[model samples]
Target: MSDIEMIRAARARIAGNLRRTPLLSAPALDAIAGRRVLLKAECLQVTGSFKARGGWSAVSAIAPEVRARGVIAFSSGNHAQGVAHAAREHGVPAVILMPQDAPKAKIDGTRALGAEVVLFDRERDDRDAMGAALAEERGLTLIKPFDDALVVAGQGTLGLELAEQANEHGVTSAEVLVCCGGGGLSSGVALALEAEAPGLRVRTCEPEGFDDVARSLAAGEIRRNDRLSGSICDAIVTPQPGNLTFPILRRLCGPGLAVSEDEVLRAMALAFRHLRVVIEPGGAVSLAAALFRPEALTGETAIAVATGGNVDAALYARALSTLE
Candidate 1:
């Protein structure tokens, strides 16, 4: 787990390289929810997701000599692009192990960033084992998607930004809805909010079948998803809560909420139509919770972090069709 000090340092380290994504307001969302809802459009961040923060933080923290040896990461998509992008910026080699079924855009994006792409079957192969073997064979550093302190600290920078932006918007208290996978972003933001925006409460949101974080919180222990091969929210389909992220979430975040696949699709379309933002299904989960599960929140001010925008054409088209 990461503390506020680590997050502050990460913010300083990556400040020059990252975009300060805006805190946006949408009247349509407000009308639907009947409250002040702010959207933290992290979908606009570098590599079209917040994963860049963690990737940069981990890569930049590496010793110059170690970085020369290269880095490795296993992700569904966003984190692969993030690590690849960060490695590219530092002139370091990156080898990414990704699911064979990961979004084509993400696979191409990672390759375009100059990383060696290794794809494995999600149903039969173990990504972690493959990544570890490759790292050992090549003397590469494994940058985990959500379980590292460096990555979590880096992700917490969003919480710092959110606190500052909410203050600027005159929001003293709010319920922040973050799409949860293995709890990297949610737990990191939870820690940051606990220190910086004490008035803001963190809530993890997930697709209905993949709501391990929510279930874990409710059960007072870490929980695992029964199956990982079914969700359209590929960006957040981890099998279980991360070892490091789970404790932070359990301590700092409130009971989580979940939304159906249809709700996630509707939220994606709503983001495009009302907020004028392109969002993936996983990225739209928090927004779905905000729009459809308002009763789960307790504050007058609500903010949802739209975490990514890397949807494939087919899924984006389907989401767009929801409005029609």
Candidate 2:
């Protein structure tokens, strides 16, 4: 179990660097969900995503000697930028392995933060194995995107902020919908909510067909996705949940919800038009579930964490055109 102390330490360590993203209220979203809807706009966070929280936590916690050799990480987009930005802040070199087809915006963003970018063929290459080998060869510390304790703890800081903000609004019992990839964010939030607001329910939302966490929780075992590169929600398309994160999620989170790509596009369009936020498909899944899956939500207060805003302009325009 993840203790609140770990999250407290993580918060303290990364507080100065990370943006304390606001909890925003949207009347249009509330009307669609038939509930009081609040958005944890993590899209507005540093690196345009919440992954920076974990990246800073992990990198800063490294032993000074190890950090001197620098760090390496594997991510689709958001985590790449997170690690790169964190490494830059620590004055360390970072090598990031990303999918060759990952959104151009994310790749450019990571490079702009001064990390060396290595592109891999997503369909043919094993990112984990490649990242491990590269780390070993360079004698660099590997930042396991979700599996590391420090990373999970860092991600949990979002939960701390959300819980406190929700309580400030007089929300006693609410349901938090999180976008699930390797269960890092979902499980981290679950652990924090468990300690901060026991009354709140944590639910995960994933892209359909990539809903490994949902099936794993249902079967009480770790599950793997059948394919790796099918979804538009590329940010959350991990083969399976992290070993460390799954247990926390299984114990603390409610049943998972899966949304289709079409639903995700619709949600992204709605976000652009009403919220004035540019949301990637992966980041829109939780909001999609909140808008479309009312039965899974537990309370009148539905708070969805919009995880990223790294969509390419062409893709964003195409998705918006679907609204017509």
Candidate 3:
């Protein structure tokens, strides 16, 4: 649904508001992957994830009068913080509907950013229904986490940066692995690369049981995950790929890749130990696939997007202990 032009405009609109996260590599990582590995360190981006790009893009694109009326979104954690932060910066009110079971750090972080937090049960409550009710009551604009055009356009900016950075590193051709949930980030990046760096292809990465995008890609249609709450990689879990995002992914992306929970923890540990960057489980899936599923990759080089670093302290400590 998002074109390169919209992505470029998003980059322009969100300029100076988000970090141009770097592409990092460590010899240790390369050794594990058995190929040249480049990690797009989006974990270091504002709000500790790449979600800020879409948040800013969606919120800023709202008409000033409408924006002042406020904005609302539903996210487990990363997207909540992103939307909350953007709303705070624009002096607008934000109400975020977050899963009651989301990491405490994310809920607290969203509140710290000045958004009103509403908690809902992931399984029983329909977040979409709740959000719509709230939006109507408060006159709040809904900024969908991944399904909206502007949000997808905003996420596409990451692909633009990746294209430029890959060129700088002499990586004209490589598989760019992205941690995917409802396909927003992956689809956006796929579109951007299709236009800017046709040689750099995108591959959707997910935790094993929740490989909806991967299954959908293989099936040539959207597929829904049977369950949503079990994976430690909660940040990237969703019911299915976005209707808007799946077509782009099916059109442009390579086969989807899935990694186990153990692989995800190990990838997080490896990221901290080797890259000196902290990565949450959901954010580490791309790196997990690159490191542990090398046989599934076709390219001589791999670029994995480390999407977030919002892990709870205890969970982080547990991940680090795995290496010990």
Identify the runs in model 3 with alpha carbons over 4 angstroms from their true place: none
Residue 75 alpha-carbon offset, candidate 2, angstroms: 0.7
Worst 10 residues of 2 by lDDT: 1-10
- Superposed on all Cα atoms, model 1 deviates from the true structure by an RMSD in Å of 0.8
Cα deviation of 57, candidate 2, in Å: 0.3
TM-score of each: 0.98, 0.97, 0.99
* Among all candidates shown, the one with the greatest lDDT: 3
Question: Which segments of model 1 are wrong by more than 4 Å?
Answer: none
Give the lowest summed-lDDT range of ten residues in model 3. Answer: 315-324
lDDT of 3 by residue, 25-88 (tens): 9999999999999999999999999999999999999999999999999999999999999999
Q: In candidate 2, how many clashes are counted?
A: 0
Better of 1 and 2 by lDDT: 1
RMSD of every candidate to native, in Å, equals 0.8, 1.1, 0.7
lDDT (10s digit) by residue, model 1, range 121-173: 99999777888889999999999999999999999999999999999999988
